[model samples]
Target chain A: MSYTTDPARIERNWRAITIELDSPRPGRLERMLQRLGLPTDVSRLVVATPALRRSWFVALGLSMLIGLLATDAAKPRDDLFVLLLIAPLVPTLGVAMAYGSNADPAHEVGLATPMSGLRLVLTRAAAVLGFSAAFLALISLLAPSAPAMAFGWLIPSFGLCSATVAAMTFMAPRRAATVAGTLWVLGVLIARGAGDDPLAAFTVVGQVLMAVVAVVGLVVAVQRRDRFDLLAVR
Target chain B: MTNSEIDAVGQADQEDRALVARIARRDRSALEQLYRRHAHWMTPRLESRCGDPDLVDMAIQDTFVSVWKSAKKYRGDGAVGAWLWGIAIRRLIDQMRKKRPTSVDLQAVGGLEHAMAFEDTLIDNGTHGSLGVALRQLDPDLRAVLIATAIDGLTTKEAARLLGVPQGTVKTRLMRARQHLQETLA
Candidate 1:
């Protein structure tokens, strides 16, 4: 009937009541991932094609076609600049379309999986960026500009795509794409208006600035990536 | 309450925080380590509440999966064990809501008897006698909030969300529960 406030005694009783049940068997989580059709191995998860489907590839091809057409239409002096501006949209939009609750149909399932939200977003972003960069590089050979000008869009594309993915962490995918796309277009227009050189935005200074922004944006994205897995706001 | 006890608690907290950080970085081994560390205690506690082994297992699985996804949101302000308990209890509640009436046969499973036995064991122990009796005397509604906020270490808001009640309601019940315990134990 008497009460005791002895901290050690209380701790002992608490520990007594907390019976340690059996730990789950190894590969139990892996089986769950297999049921969900996700990669069982965390290392293989990055290269898994679940995030990028046929629709994304179609979108990529269409975007590349549009870029090539735009480049062919523009004058020879503006060809490389036009390609630089047009090429990044493929990856920026691809990044948006490949992830996010609004973009990926399997988003809820992905969120519920063992893969961290940051890892999911980063993996998809990397795939989209890598695919688009390589595709653009191959297509740039057909552009009538110098080889340096041909690869001019690479840094800016990476920066813009990274920025878009970071933005998607806080907002819906399409909205993030719009905001990133608008900023990119406006930057190109302002640079064109300011100078006679069409490739001013892809200059050494511009490329360096873009690279810095890419790194910062990636850091920010990784920091806030948990927002992606949040239940949709009612 | 001893210095060594405090140090032990602090070390556990640091380890829990580090585990969560690793989980946020997609370290599966860290997740497994955390699961092994806490799942043993969490499983039995959740099973004691829900009284269904299947439901307890599902809740535990879902809790760790959620931890993997949202470990970045853990601010490290409180005990990590409490945070894990909060998630586990809420996941149990969610499963109960989804599978109520038909799936969880409380009477068939002797749920009330189990809970009573749990209470009696705590009250019989001299260390928990007063607190246990006070808790057993409160209405189930009030007791649930008290157990969630006080025993499980969930925030009032988190407790309210888990109980599907307003934050104000949880606070009021908590205050009333405390007053009743004070009066009875006095």
Candidate 2:
């Protein structure tokens, strides 16, 4: 009848719901994650991974530069070795910052959702690993000098990422990542020093050990999964 | 307008701008104040553009929501009312885009004609100056085209379709109306 279409209706509705056209949707990576079947909330959590952000990409780009330059500076045989070592290490930082109040701005809102905290963190960790493996695979494939399969780092990355998540159950995200990453770098260096070849850490025995670490870390993370659900004071 | 009336209007505009600034900082109260004040007048204008009240409600909701999200984008070069209308019209177009109009409907035709008449009455109510006098003096056909494009923020094609005339005819009528208004005001 009248020209005015009840404003109160919208007022009540908007107060009840947000993040439609009203709030900012997560940026492009989140949209990609959504298309891949992660729910909207979970995709948002995945994108908030600090290591997956633009600044981190700049760091990745620098690492790629190092990969490119390492080939030119070192022996012809050492091109893929640098990338193999770097690829598995990338997800370590991402998985570390994937959860925790200090890292995710929407951590509270995400935890409050029906999704369990373990599911949220694990999903984000998997996404981080997938993205890191993909980008690193791209680098290794595109390297001017490399062997047939540059994916040798994939298993090692899983081990270290799993170790980081398992460690997250014990302490802060950054601290967990630091401990796992340090151990990984140290283990690889020690393996290289003790063994004849420098790529000894990527050998069959090393691969088997890393896979075992992955399984054990995941089991431990699951056992302590409830820790992710709690709001730890910073 | 008298000195006091002009001062009151200026203060209201300032208040709206302040609310926009607060909304940029995500103040819910300021957003509510803005929606209440501007949408109070904006709804009737929107209702005149579209026949469906539900569509009107959707558009208003979209406009305010967009304002909240994009408040920081407000340049403040003009009145908040002007900035708001820019968003409102686009949101209305987007909402209308979602639901395609039926190809042939007598109700749609009548609503378009009725809306034109309503616009004429709206112009009549606001005929407070020389511009209004010039607007009132224009032919009804020319006035409808002018209002559709100039006030309702529709494109030439949209105005043509709304008035059921050719796009060239809408353009010619708009130019003629603008030229006439300019001559009258000058």
Candidate 3:
């Protein structure tokens, strides 16, 4: 017939969400990673792989030369430069293909695991970046002149290419991403025809523009978080 | 600061950071180090929730798989412990949900509607120390949501995601659960 407002009574009656200050088990995460076929050594080898990393740097060098030729300051080969600028996109395209090939089971299995969506994105990106960086470094070494000669243009070119790739990736469907990427690369060729210095054109101003594209892409991806199926090839 | 205490703190910080970095790189050793660091706490917590040793073990296994795949995404934004908790909670929910028929809509709680009536009776009469007893009386669904959101301190949005419910549903269920708990205690 009586009511009690006692704080201790209320606390005692209310279930505390029991939390244990311990971990799951020894060797569990390692075994899980191993099951996913992503062992440390393999990851390291993937990062250190020459084929995966250098393609981007090679593309960067070639693009810069094409840019220089577009400026028509020295009449270096025009057709050759076009091919060079086009080369880097191949690896990313290959990535799309590889991702598409394993689209089903990988996504299902990955989703079944405890990994968050953000972690998945970061790991995939890091693997790609490591390979690309190594390749760039290698090209710089084999042709000392290339790194030294293109140092000024390298940053802008890389920034633009990366920004474009990142931006285009957010486009719905792989077809669109592919189309956008192709258009952007072709846009460089058009800029060449405008008789402007490609290197000069892709300066800080170009970087800022590319950065804007990248930021927009990031926002779009974040906003569409729920729709990003691991099974979707794009 | 005391020299010995400071050194211990420094060592712990280094070890934690190293473990996280290695996990990001998909290093099994790093993953093992992380598991050793957290398993003692996580296992018992999961075991308490499921009350089934085998289910708890499976949940733990699933949690680590998630961690390995997503390690690169850590970003060091939150405490590693908290991140681990987040993963474990989600994995546990997934396991629970999977037990239902494939035809069952994950968003719908229709199958467990009967459990709510039983859960309502779990209200205790303001006995402060009897909280665990009251919790044990709760339906599994209500118990899980309360433990995850109220006790674990996960945001409602996160709880909704883990439970595979819409945000509105999580709020409704959480409010109802709290009211039951308050009345039971009072």
User: Best candidate, TM-score-wise?
Assistant: 2
Best by lDDT: 2
- Model 3 chain A: weakest 10-residue lDDT segment is A12-21
Which residue pairs collide, candidate 1?
none
**Candidate 1 lDDT over residue span A121-198, tens digit each:** 777788678777877777887776557777888888889988987887778878988899999989988988899987
lDDT of 3 by residue, A1-234 (tens): 121123442232122211121333425434554567786644543343233444544666676444444544343333234333543453444333222223223555656566554344435544554444444444434332343433232333334334433443354334543765577677667766676564433556654665676566556556654444444543
What would the per-residue lDDT of candidate 2 be over residues B36-55, giving only the tens digit for each residue? 78776676676666665566
> What's the lDDT for residue B18 in model 3?
82
Kindly give the stretch of ten consecutive residues in candidate 1 chain A with the minimal lDDT sum. A1-10
RMSD (CA, Å), each prediction: 16.9, 9.7, 17.0
Q: How close to the true structure is residue A54 of candidate 3, measured as C-alpha lDDT?
A: 47
Q: What ranges in model 1 sit over 4 Å off?
A: A1-51, A55-63, A66-74, B1-186
Selected candidate, larger lDDT, 1 vs 3:
1
Give stretches of model 3 more than 4 Å off: A1-84, A87-91, A94-105, A140-173, A198-201, A230-234, B1-186
lDDT of 2 by residue, A69-181 (tens): 75754454466666666677788888877788888888888778777888877888998898878777777767766675467888999999999999988999999998998
